[model samples]
Target: MALSVVDLYRDILPKTNCGDCGFPTCLAFAGMVVSEKHPIDGCPHLAPEVVERCNQELAEQYAAGKWTKRDLAEDALTWAKERSASMNLSDLPGRIGGELLDTDSGKALKLPYFGGHVIISEGDITRADDRELTRWEKVFIYNHLSQGGSRMPIGKWKGFEEFPNTVSKIKTMAGHVEAPLVDRFHGRLAELVDAAKRIGGMEMTGKAHSADAAFFFRPFLRVPVMLLFWDEDPADGFGATAKLLFDETVIEHLDIESIVFLSERLRQLLCDAADEAPQKGNT
Candidate 1:
């Protein structure tokens, strides 16, 4: 197994939020070291020997493909929430293209999620209806805010394989993200399009396009995802495939793990919506 951020926090480096490593907290520093390949020796509290050992171990694991961007869960959420909370929520609306609303509790920003909205305050994020989000969902949103991305989408699209350092995640995106949708909507292209539109995908007319269907989505201000579906043709022996394309600018807004997580969640939402839409085959 790869060296995990949680393990490194628990084992090495004095657990002090000393900010000696140029991060706000030790957890933040550890996450940077493990995930972003920040030098492990940046923590001033670590002895030279300790840094040497960790550097050698991490170097080997990373070279062996054991190190990849982690989900940044649990304590990661803690650090992310703290980091986001320190920002001025009032300024987040312009920064993220979110709508600020005055609620009885205080103020919050309503950001688009799938086809719906999620309200994020300084303390926590909730669905538009005030329901709690899963830890991963919360963490994802917090990390987005922590990234502080503000670039506008350039409109060009690319596949997951186009990004740098995405080799470890290409299979994951295929198996978990694309394959599931392909399996679910194989013979149900009509249903798939309906679900996608219902969940904020704008149907795109295929003009001289080889793809059977295409749709576009702006899951975030800077992060736009395009879906290209090629329905199976039994006569041609072609299997149904769903390929998700991302804006070339997505890397600036989301890390690898978060982008994959976003896709998985989007697939779930699309599948759920398709189930609820009137199914032609159901009758």
Candidate 2:
């Protein structure tokens, strides 16, 4: 069979997905190229041979030096349609009833609805009420606090109180939480999910999960403007996680700005973490 577009795109570059093209990953940039949404030149990773090969097919388009822009738009729309069709909220469980809010980063002590607490010391322990234990059932929360370069005493909470044994913490780089553009992007996400709910396409709750509070939404989109916190299982350590598991198509259609913001945030978050975490000198 002929080389698949994905394969072709991968072949011409390092495929390390370093985001040099200003896109989150290599494949995303390739999709834009194949769709003629962006020109091959947009990718800094492109080798001279690859550029020459692409030039032949895009000779006419390149005359105006608009190949990349044209292709980016085309690919973006196609990607968006595919994303919408592929989005599935079905697998996701139903929504919870309360609303709690906190900073995207998990550092803030907001969201009192869940009676959130922390263990500031290694031996520090906070007991949880068995009755309140059930409140953590079936939810998801993303904490942005750990995204900073700071190493917190979070692990201490690991064994404290009734904190679910299922809790998982995600550490990332810094600068994601401070980006101003994130406000509009997250606002849009909130609005979109709300709109989705109005049409019976959503399940939302505003509760914070202490154990897994920062578990959702990382590595994929880590912009400082927004942090996601959720509890997919209330009994499972607050269900907070950092995994970005949106549909492939939805992942494709994600607004570039949103993707950029999130990706940059994640990058910074990870960077910050490495800087702060104790490390041995090169052996």
Candidate 3:
């Protein structure tokens, strides 16, 4: 007879009860493995051969669980609220092509004009002037901004800086890489670069471009993407700017090739944007 999970644990798992796998005890891990909540690989003691067998068993269990289609009871409003909190607006202004939403006031006001004809003012407001973003462009910005936690924009507005300025940082990060995982990453970077050029209309300097280049190419490549944009006056000319810095662990893994790839891709994007909109002045 095949060994039961309990039987396998009694024979195979180390009795040491280490929390290496985060479970409190070997027996608990064993039980969880059987239920498919914990993988067999979590057991440090099983000989590799035994581990493989356990993995196979767990895979079968996982497949069976999938076929059963588990039902979950959930509160609809809570779900919606949780989902809304993850919502992205990076490209919403460009798509909607009207105004930016003021988070505090719950009102949408026209883009590019701030505090000129207003009374109530506290939080920062962001606006995008470009009116020509494709549907996919909008979604890419929205999803990456909203759903990609911690990477979301800090706030839409600051005292003087607004969305048009903020989007440029999105533009910088967007150029970082063409992920081998998907063709969309390449296409999206192109669209972001173009949209940024068309809308923000900023002619970034060699130094600014170089700094952004370092992020996508070397330091940023190593990090597990934590994109946070905020306004900083690192220097006077770099005014009311968006700066992106990643987690340290990610920077450790970067290689020169990654930097080169990022640089080439970014250059292509910038050149393309230049070709598309020669008239717009640099922001």
Candidate 4:
């Protein structure tokens, strides 16, 4: 079988967004390569042996007409479906922190989310309110189905840097997720708190750090995230800062990329909520 462009790209590149490849992110560079706009050599960090192997794989895939990116999500969903199909529905509730319920179609697992309840059965996903699941939501479900474990959250929190294989992604995570929040809500604790609460976040008290505000978000059943923000103090010369933490088991539920995606999405959600909130001077 021909290898996927995503798989091949992952194998060839250094997975670092060094910007020497002329793209903001390595994933963007991979897209360009898959579309044939750039060659694999565009990435300067690849070792010689890896480059040769990737070129060989890319050649075979091109010859086989499997160089398209259109079916990447579908392929991932199919893979997750296959994994879920082999598991017993009854056991999923305990394993994935979901609640199993009987539906007209059959047994299904219901996991709560910020938007609504997500129903999963045999690797298929649907919303409890009869709405269609978004592409990101589907991806989250696929990841949960494949990576979720039977363990529960132990209440211990660690930052993204603490997660396994995530050191290289720390810069991206901070730039995309934490910086945006700090930029938007700096010194606006009330607005930040309101936004967090609107998005199903709970305020955490008595933290050891000097964080002005801390909120916990559960974007998925098994994925718990904690965000802390420290307001800027000009007199003290301390600029505003934000830090996001997750359970140690988070790595077992989603890859670093997916976790980053979730954080960015949460940032957007908070920004939207802040915009809709009533201002002090507004009517």
Cα lDDT over the full model 3: 0.38
Indicate the worst ten consecutive residues by lDDT in candidate 4: 1-10
**On a 0 to 1 TM-score scale, where does candidate 2 land against the true structure?**
0.21
The sequence of per-residue lDDT tens digits that candidate 4 reaches over residues 82-124 is: 7556677787777777788988888888888764688887647
Local distance difference test, per candidate? 0.82, 0.35, 0.38, 0.77
lDDT digits (tens) for residues 111-158 of candidate 1:
987666898876678898776677877777877776778888887788
Q: List where candidate 1 sits over 4 angstroms from the true fold.
A: 1-76, 103-105, 281-283
Residues 167-283 of candidate 2 have per-residue lDDT tens digits of 221211112332322332222333323332332222323443332222223121221112343323446544223223222222222232333334443434443444454443321
**Runs with alpha carbons beyond 4 Å of true place in candidate 2:** 1-4, 58-283
**Candidate 3 local Cα displacement, residue 237, angstroms:** 63
Candidate 4: residue pairs that collide: none
Ranking by TM-score: 1, 4, 3, 2
Better of 2 and 4 by TM-score: 4
Please report, as a residue range, the 10-residue window in candidate 2 with the lowest summed lDDT. Answer: 133-142
Write the number of the candidate with greater TM-score, choosing between 1 and 3. Answer: 1
In TM-score terms, which candidate is top? 1
In model 3, pairs of residues that clash are 124-157, 126-163, 201-282, 201-283, 202-282, 202-283, 203-282, 217-259, 222-250, 223-250
What does candidate 3's lDDT look like per residue over 1-283, in tens digits? 3435577568778867897878888887776766545667766656788777766765766666632223221232233234335443444344322344465566443432111111111222222443343332222222222232333233222211122233443433334432221232222333333444443333332433442211221111112221112222346544222233333322122222322333333334444554565343322
TM-score per prediction, in order, is 0.69, 0.21, 0.24, 0.69
